[model samples]
Target: MRQVIQLRTEQLGATARTTLSARSALAWALIELQRHEEAVAQLRGLLPLVLAAWGEHHEAANGVRLHLGTAHFASGRPARAEELTRVVLAVYPVMDGLRLRAWTLLASALSCLGRHREAADEYTALLNAASPVYGEDDRQLLWVRTDRLHQLAFLAEHDLVEQESRALLAGLADDDPLRAAISGAHAFVLNSAGHHAPAETIVRAALAHHDGADLCLGLARSLNGQGRHEEALRILTDARTRCRQSGDTEHVSLLHTLTARALLGLERLDDAETQARQAVEAARTHHGPTHHRSLEAATTLASVLAARGRHTDAREHLTHCAAAWRRQFGPHHPRTIATDAELAAVPKA
Candidate 1:
């Protein structure tokens, strides 16, 4: 396919350009194939040509911009993706399929940038607009709800996560593919509230239907909470391997964070520190520095440092983490409160 694309590009004359629509289709194909760099480059090169030919607000140009946004988001530039998606939506205010796509991409980008509240609002907008066309039980609406629930979880609004998850699940069939995701999110809510036994049971059942990274992550968290460090480590190792092979960088960061916690539980301080550091870097690279996952990884690293008797380093790290969490989620949010507690627990040098 790469060779075909190259040949097609070479066949074009100086005076003859490929149709922007055809180029857009090729770019989308490249994105699906995970050739993000090529897709981004192709879309970037096509954007000016599209704008010159059809004008900025032309449907064709907006389509290219939308595709470019998707490529940017996939390539770990969520802020740029969000900008492009907003431009697309601004040009088309009506509720159409293309506008819906723009909204989805915008919400996803906001979420990845650690703007969970904005993401939740965007998802709400999407749900409200989509329900009239696709109805309440549409698969797309269900997934949108799932994404909002996840944002609520990140914001430490666990009660809402649980409430919405239950309501969403009640309507989903057992055989629905969306069921696994809903169950996983529900388990995450359970695990976050320190209900490890129930969380473990919920995630284990979800795994029976879909062996996904989110379910594995929830299960690992449950085991780690129970002090079953070895079991958690084993599950994380397998999930991390699969995520690495599939190029699921976000999940790989999540798995690494959990693995570090498991190792810390087992008193493997050095190994835990190494995994924790890697997880922090991965989360920062893929999800940005302010994302909840990045902060969580930093917190795990601080714990490992404290366990190694590097209390000074732990104290400094936890101080930053606590301040960041407080800013992002406020003083009373679970993350801010927990991080403050961890900072207070760190011994002074």
Candidate 2:
């Protein structure tokens, strides 16, 4: 495929003038093949040709811009995607399929930007417009609802999370390929709502087929919530291995924290301390000290240290964690209040 693309590009470029159409074809092919960075580079190089050929207002020129926007999002450059997608949507004719696609890209960019409210609004708009055209039960709408469900869970809107998750699950067949994923998501909601036993059942069943990172994590959490610490530890050990091989560093760190929690439950204080410390250090290194993931990792470590009777160490860690939570989430934030409570439990020097 690379050779074929190169041959075509060379044949096209050998002419006195390159046709943006031919170049766009190659760029589109690369994007379709999931070679996003290559597509971005190809499109960028074709930019001058595109502008020269279509004079910016032509449909072909706008098509290149839209494709480039999608490639930017696929390549994990959400900020660039946000900029390009907005440009296309502004002129891309409202109520058209192209405009709707631009909205999808824009919503994805906003979600990755941590602008959760904006993302939710975008998805809501996308679904509202889409349902009128394609109806509410369209398969394409599942991804939008799943993304919205995650946002609701993060915002502590648990009821909405449950509602959306179940809605998604209901749309799928019992034996559908996506059933395991949906079941895992629903299990997460149940676990969050304190229905640990049922969450465990759902997650365990999902893991029997799916092997998704989310399912693995959910299973561990459900087991932990039910005080089945040994089972959680056993599951997380395998999960860490699978996640490591898949190059999911964040999940590997999460597995460590979950392992620490399981170890703490089993009264394996020393090992719990070791695993918790590792999780905290790795999360801070990868996600930054003030990042949400880092705070979560640090909290696990503080819990382990306190449980292990290292009160001084726990006090110091909790104090630092509390300050970070206050800075990131504010004093009135749930996370900050929770961290403050942990810090208050430690005896002062």
Q: Which digits, one per residue and each the tens of the lDDT, describe model 1 over residues 1-349?
A: 5455445545664333456678889999999998988999999988877676566777878889999999989989999999999999888776777888899999999989988889999999899988998898877778889888888888878888888888988966676778788887788767777899999998888787787777888899999999999999889878887787776776877888999999999998888999999999989998998888888999999889989999999999999999989887789887788878888887787
**Candidate 2 at residue 60, lDDT?**
67
What alpha-carbon RMSD in Å does predicted model 2 have with respect to the real structure?
5.8
**Stretches > 4 Å off in candidate 2:** 1-39, 55-76, 94-98, 244-250, 267-295, 305-337
Model 2's TM-score against the true structure: 0.75
Q: What are the lDDT scores of the predictions, listed in order?
A: 0.85, 0.75
Worst 10 residues of 1 by lDDT: 9-18
Among all candidates shown, the one with the greatest lDDT: 1
Model 2 Cα lDDT, one tens digit per residue, 77-116: 7778889888776765556666777788887777656555
What TM-scores do the predictions have? 0.92, 0.75
